[model samples]
Target chain A: MLDEIDRQLLQSYQRDFPLVHDPFGEIGRCLGIEEDEVITRYQRLKDDGYISRIGPLLNHTKVGVSTLAAISVPAAMIDSTAGMINSYEEVNHNYLREHHYNFWFVVAAKDNERVDAVIQEIERKSGTDALVLPMVKSFYIDLGFKLWQSTQAD
Target chain B: MVTDQDIIRIMQAGLPLCPEPYASIAASLELDEAELLRRIDAMLRQGTIRRIGLVPNHYRIGYRYNAMTVWALDEDRIDAVGELFGAQASVSHCYKRPSYPPGWPYNLFAMVHGRGLDEINDKIAALKKLIGDDCRQSDVLFSEKILKKTGIRLKNRSSEHA
Candidate 1:
């Protein structure tokens, strides 16, 4: 469980990590804690697997590409396929879902062509045909969530 | 350097869907568009602006079929295991989460989206062939509804929105 100060820290920093040279210093000033404490706690959170990363979330469209991919792995082979998929730097995330297309992941690249090429490589290597679904239009949403501060309203 | 006020303005205005959005933003700020572009380019290079793109309202967009997939594998093979799913294009996000309690079989998490259930099923089949027999249990956490989706403006002064 997180205390009020911890919650506040997450609310402030989760989605938008400050861009300054010394972000911990800026965050420390806000929390009235030492910069080193901020860094230590954050590192602790990551080490414990509470937060996956502490960095910028780039705009893929601006870079000219992004893809939302999914596959149906047999109840048996998920381990091997996940290992193969996550190894590629182009593949940022891989998830196993409840639906028939249980294996899903996202691939962001420099453009649509590159994104397609990466998908093809996966198909060739894994011998699985991955369905490519890129974002056509987004009405509203942000993927970032605050697990540390659950008391805050979503 | 960007101030809290600047962050507010950028988040509130949203990214312009124009050919030259940074230039358009600069026009409003009364700064040279070229200089503004240079700053934005630098910020991106430095990992300041994580992403500038559409926030998918999957429900509103009729993409009701979405799920969080999880896999449990021996610690030794995690990296090799995760890479298989990550390479696919359908997956939007993936990571290694802690294993579920005794009743659950999911250890690795990935977010996959589809137009409907049928399409999602077909994709899952192909994945099974790829991973082999050590998959353990794969569970799907379908999203029932969207709670909220808004970018965080790191330096903003107001907490009222929170």
Candidate 2:
């Protein structure tokens, strides 16, 4: 269960994390707590699956190139096919989203050539054509999500 | 010559929760602390680092439903309409991508997340109403399982440091 301070810690620091010598101490000062308390709460949150990370989100564009790709697979083959796709280090995310194209995943690599190579390799092995949809433009900088209102003692 | 890669490689595993986080990282990189901070700030200015902050697991935080809605919008109005869709509070990631015709006809992609079924449905309906008739066709994709994410196949076992 999250206390008021835990909720505040999660909600307030989604962006613009402190960049000082003692970041946890800095956060503690902001929330009227101590450095050790802030660190302990963040650690607890991670252990309990409340957060994934607490640091820099790099722009993938600056890092590499990537694409959104999908393949429609038979019900029986979904598991095997997903596993096969996941075997490649270039593939970053694989999700079984619904549709005729029921399996969607992303292929990210250091360059366009490598990204395309991975897609082709997947197609060759899977025997199903991939629907590649690369981004043309982005509309917003996702500053991070605002906390939804808690309904119960969670 | 402490490059961005050197700094990021150490920091990307998720900042160490210590009293002196950045200083510790800089020390590991064998570079001056001020130089590291300056480089990071410079990257932020150049849009290399989007944000330096917390990434919550929305599912754990009560946002149980995540719906990806795709709209087949006119080419000319995609810019204006995409902005409007992105500005919605529930929408997290929004992008304009090419649509393969005959079957797939969506150019604008937006994700809407909610706590439950009723709330998610209401949010989708509201988005359609917001877009009005410009939405020629639309579809929603609910993921059954996350086959793989980052480097972990999450039954929540692996140390997911994304």
lDDT of all predictions: 0.57, 0.83
Collision pairs in model 2: none
**Which candidate number maximizes lDDT?**
2
Task: Report chain B TM per candidate.
Answer: 0.78, 0.89
lDDT by residue for model 2 over B1-162, one digit each (tens)? Answer: 767866766676788877888888889889888888888888888977878888888889888777888899989989988999888877888999999986888999998888888998998999989979888889999767878777311112132232
TM-score for each candidate, following the candidate numbering: 0.47, 0.92
| DockQ, each predicted model | 0.05, 0.60
Model 1, span A31-139: residue lDDT tens? 7888878767765544454443443354555534666676766868777777877776567657665566666677766567867888898888777777666654332
lDDT of 1 by residue, B1-162 (tens): 655247434644444423344556667777776666557557566555654332323443345677666667676666666767766655656666554357444556666777788866765666666788768667666754332223232323463243
lDDT of 2 by residue, A21-105 (tens): 7889998998899999999999999999998987778788877888999988889998789889989877878889878898888
Off by over 4 Å in 2: A149-154, B151-162
